[model samples]
Target chain A: MLNPVIEMVDLTKKYRSFTAVDCLNLTVGKGEIFGLLGPNGAGKSTAILMMLGLTEPTSGMVSVCGINSTRNPIEVKRKVGYLPEEVGFYDNPTGMENLLYTARLNSIPESEAKKRAEELIERVGMAEAKHKKTGKYSRGMRQRLGLADVLIKKPEVIILDEPTSGIDPQGVRDFLQLIVSLKQEQGLTILFSSHNLHQVQQVCDRVGIFVKGKLQSVGDIESLSKQLFTESLCLIEAGIHEFPAENTDTKPVRKLLEPINGIAKIEHKKGVFEIECTSDLSATIAQTIVNAGYGLNFLNKKEYGLDEIYNRYFEGGIQHG
Target chain B: MKEGYNMVKKKVSEDTTGNQKKVKRPAKEKPKHPFWVIVNKEVSDHVRSWRFIILVALIALTCLGSMYTALNNMGDALKSSKTGELFFFLKLFTVSDNTLPPFFVFISFLGPLLGISLGFDTINSEQNRGTLSRVMAQPIYRDYILNAKFTASMIVISVLFFALGFLVMGLGLIAVGIPPTAEEFLRVIFFIVLSIFYVALWLNLSILFSVRIRQAATSALAGISVWLFFSIFFNMIVDLIAKGLAPSSFAPEYVIVKFQKMILNLMRISPAQLYSEATTTLLMPSVRSTGPLTMEQVAGAIPSPLPLGQSLLVVWPQVTGLIAVTILLFALAYVAFMRKEIRSS
Candidate 1:
């Protein structure tokens, strides 16, 4: 990642005997949206807190914007905006007032804070409801105001914990769309943690799956599938019907493909031969079949959705989540 | 009295003579103090809260009613005034009728309720609202939340007590047709300062409970229970202990006095006891001592009202104790809040 804005190297946090985040090592580059996907109590929130310098790690280090959060949390806080999983506001204050108060906490000048607050309120689609007390706001409205609240500080990196958990489907779509625009138009790096896989899949440029305090995989969809599916890829299909062959028997193709690496069993019918491999051997199988004087047809590697990927690596935590 | 807090560090104006000006000035300026936004927001919250409004109205009605009775009795006190009874204005605070307590007595009673009402849910309600972590994630110290709540509450207390004190004095001036002497004025200001410390003790106690308890109602209950334990039950407990370990009638008089002093010291453990003693000494001025004084100490003393300095000397331990206990409670709350896990509800 170029100019990584958020980095956690070997980060660990333990509460007495139970480890919350174990050896978390990840980097989020500038202007990137990194989603931390996990089940509840899977330590995603803990890692986010440590990244924001809100919770001290039991071991290792977390740095935000190149400032070691553990050593100088205040400096990190000045540049990083964190929206907790359950965003809260003072009940009596209007949404407008709440955003202004956050602006003040960040030491924004009075006029500047007001201007930024008004702009953000409008940008987050909260202009009509900004005058209403936050106590009367719906959960989704509060989440939107929470977005505006984090932006009032003009932060370089925005860390959101479950930004779309309790919203309706349409609201979630709008909120996720706003987050992407905020990153693209303003060049803000965004890191959000979510237990919902669909939300993570929709907006994240890259993702890390957390299971029981450990990161199982971290990459974009294709790369993550590549990392996860390469090991368990048991079936390989090679078609050889294009080239005319006098022999119409299965023994010829099976004999050609059986010598490939990681092949456990072979079955042949018509022009397609199925090779069962203990590990990924698609490349070697294609090369051997083509080199043995048979026209190599097509290679198959299973395309996976996040659900299948989630179920594959997070089988133990799936039901609980 | 940790006076120069970082957030409210008022470099607004250096005129120490005017209390109201100092109180009202910093709030109008550009927020130079970090988290002045929080202090300002919290102050407005307390002012707008119905709970705070009700408590202030209660204190106001009771103080005004007591002051009215004190006004009615001022004629008799004036006619029977002695040679050294120079504080005619001070009499309005201490002179009580059969039906009502004096002005100071009413304050001591309701001040704790006011403090607890403002602070019992200071931390827990914010946690329940899910704002604690969001605020703590800002570029400020964790102690800022607790300290700012405390500072704002203390500001309200000081403003209310001062306003009430000046209001009563202004009414007394209109009715009694006499202004307070300089000494009496200083004594009344000192009394208001003392009441701030008293209410501050309760405020810090309630904040401590808020930091430790997860539920707002539970923390409020815990604060009230402690107040009840100290105010009503403490004297009874001390009496029971005294009766259990009383020196016999056959014992030496010095031994009996020593035993009585021990019991008195035990009774002083309650904050109300210390506040009342300090109030009586400072407001009455004729109160020579707070404890049993031997003949030798009282041998050459004249039967006259002590000056403000001597009265302060008399209650120095109580005032210091109030300040000390208030700071100690604040420190305890600060440490608890800083170390607390930043979980939202």
Candidate 2:
């Protein structure tokens, strides 16, 4: 059995009467990219702060690399690298100077620090802007420099809070690719938080959906969809050029598809009939609709993506309360 | 999914093997202490800043202007009386004509400005720029940042004052053609050290405000307000209070004496009063005491200046009071900073 590199055991944080994080128990295995997906004000940032020991939890424990973070933060800090949301550096110093200062703070030797900074600068694709003042750099450039800043200490676990919040679409794609490469090439365990479900699905091995400071669901995308829907759903859309002499009549298609074992429901609107059923049933239903002498103009099966799964869970939560 | 699992397994094995070797190598090289690292970075940042340059230049220009005036008067005195042996070097710092106050007075007045300017933004600016959290995330204790900031700024202040002192001494030697005696040289050195401590008190106060106030501008304003109250209005307020307590002129001599003592103790609460009294005793040896002396006590005394040891005794309490206040302010700032929430943006 392999041990998790980063673990939170019933971690909780509260400010006055408001609980920001409520008994969060998370485990990130070695060499895993875990995306913490939630909307704004959902305790993602607070949880990251607690994990890095930058904030004292109201209760519970957080351990990084097997060291209790609250009890021994300095030891944990040495092994963990954190890139805060909208990370800022000393504006007056050049990018190289900023990285060198961070390296020195981590107690790396001067010569070695310089070499590592240069290597990281090139790796993050900021070699051209290494000598420029960080204040003059663009948001994308600053984010790249921030990535290099986190890697200078060669941390085993990296924590990023909303790393792609304000970046452009292309830059977000490029940045996510860079993060994936870092995990693969350097074998760093990464835990990043974001509100963008689609982006998280692109790079994360597993994701935890947070709602109102609670972990509503936690698993890979496929497993989460299974847990939410119980059975995979497929939708069949068929066009009807002619109705049965009535605008509200869906009887002909209903009569043909009602007896199918996995067909759950059928909805008719404006000349198109939609049929919902279990997996691989869309083809059989489409054949049935055509066999009943209706014009099957088009058929499509919609698999559940993270966006739909998130909406279902979040909406369910709202309606329940 | 199976492919991803296989890739992750391979990477983890590679990492464990590589981490073992890399960890062994770093263990051999002892890490530098966090104190020195913070000190080095802060020193470089302060020295290269435009604020330090402008402040140092202002002090230098004013000091030279006062020194020039003192030198002209000393030349005239040397020609007339030829009595420059007592504190020839000390005269360069303390002697002034009607054109200006002496160098000691100028420093005691403007020294707080240097301190407040250096420290008003030390912690708050870091917090506003969002660098405090990042720096605190490093492998260092929380208090190291505050302590290093004070130490680095103090080092800069000492260097500036010592350099200016030496420059004045060298110029005086060339202009007046007289070297200071051993006692005079020691007195000048002691004055410089005392001036550093006095300015450090203001620096610590400003840092305390910086920790308490969220905005750098507000902290700077608060620091200056304290300086202004002490420098300008505190003595007047103390006088009013003493008079209100003992208003009758026909009161007994003992009553008057007690009220006067109360007034003097009240004034000593201000660092400006303490610094000015200490420096006056050090630079002007003829001033034997700070309080009023009775006629009987003064009748038997000779009209000679006190020695360096006795002058030190006269000002020892003031010196210690300044130090105590400085430490108290610094301790308050340290506790406030250590307990502050790092994520409160």
Candidate 3:
């Protein structure tokens, strides 16, 4: 069994009467990108802060690298790199200078720190802005620089809270790609929180969905999809305003898709039709739609995107709570 | 397929192992990095800051200006054949035998401003820049952070005070054409301590206000208002109280006694007044002797006058109280800042 790098066993954080994180349990294994998917105010940042031991948990246990975070926060901090959602830095210091300072704070040797800073700066695509004062950097640029700062110690666990929250489209893409590269190249264990569903789904090996301070689901996206909706779904898009349209009994309907396998049921709404399957048949249906004379408006796997997952879990959690 | 499963299993283990590697070192022993790093950063930033520079420069300029003014008065007094003790003493201020040196006036007024400026924003700027939380997140204890700040500010204030003292001594040397005798030098050191204490008392007051009042502007205003009340308005109130409260049949001698008692009482509560009194005692030899004395000795008596032991006794309370209050205020700041949740966004 894989050992958990960061684990929270019924971790709870309360601000007075308001419970910000309620009995939250989570685990991110080594060398995997774990997406903490949540909407704003869903306690994602609170959980991240608790993992870093910046905020004390109201109850339960939090351990980073098997070291109890609350009992030994400084030890936990040394092992984890945290990039807060809104990254702030010393405005007077240059990007490189700030990273060097943070490296010193983390007790990295000066010579090795310089080398790592240079490496991470380039890795984060911040080499061009390395010498500029962080005060003058754009939001995306600041986030990139912040990531570079967090990596100064080459921390064993990287916890980034909404790392791409306010960046532009290209910036978000570049940021996600960098995280992917880090995961692949460094085997970095990352616990990332983001509202960007596509990016999280694309990069995360497993995801934990949080809503209203509650962890609603935690699994690989495929498993989560199946567990949440109880079947594999395919979004079938076609022209002529209906599915099984007028030719329901035709050979095309029967020969094209009926016998493939694992489809449990089908439903239609507006221009899109949903196919519930015992096994994923997204490719087969897309091919079938393409081969048929029907105009294939859109055909895609019905994985819950981050946005839809947030709406489903977050809104539902809010109502439930 | 088995190999693939094994690889995935190994990947997870590696991630956990990597985390374990980082946590092992710290759990085994306390990290020395956070304490040294914060102390170095605090000192370096303060040393390079504009406020520190301005503080030093202002002290130097004020010392030079006062020295020049003192020299001009000395020159005028010497030109007149009345090189008598009373003439020189009066010339130290109003060129009359009846008053205190104007230089003491400058010390009382200038010292508190320097003190207030040093402390009014020490905590506020860190909070404003959002670095306070980050600084606290380090492994070093919270008291160390406040200690470093207080130590850095005191170092700056001390440097300015001593530099100004030296500048005055140098100016006195050039004008009088003699290095201060050892006695005069001792007296001058005592007076400098007194002056610095006056400023430090205000500095401590400002620091306390800084902690109590969340806004830097408000803390500054509080420092200034207190300084103004003591420097300008207090004397008038003291005189009014003395006059109204004194018996109509009170003789001139009795009046002097009443006045002296009232003045000492007022100076006890106000550091600026204490500084002025101490400065008078150090600079004017006549005040030391408790009778009429010469003028050149007023500035001359500063360098070294009484025995070192006696000088220490003369200003011991001022020095001790100032430092005590400074420590007390910083303690308050430390407690408040530590209790404050860092989520002050």
TM-score of every candidate relative to the true structure: 0.85, 0.90, 0.76
TM-score ranking, best first:
2, 1, 3
lDDT, residue B321, model 3: 61
Badly placed stretches (over 4 Å) of model 3 are A231-234, A240-301, A318-321, B1-40, B75-107, B135-139, B193-267, B282-308
Candidate No. with top DockQ:
1
Candidate 1 lDDT at B216 equals 88
Candidate 3 residues A57-94, lDDT tens each? Answer: 88999998999988888788777887766677777779
| Candidate 1 share of real interface contacts | 0.70
For all candidates in order, the CA lDDT equals 0.86, 0.86, 0.71
DockQ of each: 0.53, 0.38, 0.16
- Total colliding residue pairs, candidate 2: 0
Report the C-alpha lDDT of model 1 over B1-345, residue by residue, as the tens digit.
Answer: 457664355554444448778676566546446657678888998899899889889999999999999988877777777844588789999887578989888888888998898899999888888899899878998878888889999999999999999999998899888889999999999999999999999999999999999988999999899888887888889989999999899999799889989998998888888999999999888899999988888999997889999999999999988899999999999999888888783
**Backbone clash count for every predicted candidate, in the order shown:** 0, 0, 16
lDDT of 2 by residue, B1-345 (tens): 999999998997677685585775666466577788888888889899998899889889889989998887876655654444566567788777868888988898889999999999889888887688778878888888999999999999999999999998888888878888888888888999999999999999999999989999999999999999998899889978886897489988778877788888889888998998999999888788887676777898887888999999999999999999999999999999987876636
**Which digits, one per residue and each the tens of the lDDT, describe model 1 over residues A1-321?**
779899899999999999999999999999999989988999988898898788899999889889999999999999988899889998888999888888888877776888999999999999999999999999999999999999888899999998898899999999999998898899999997998888889899999999989988789977876666564445676667553344466666667766666777776655556676767788888777777776676877544668877887777443332
On DockQ, the stronger of 1 and 2 is 1
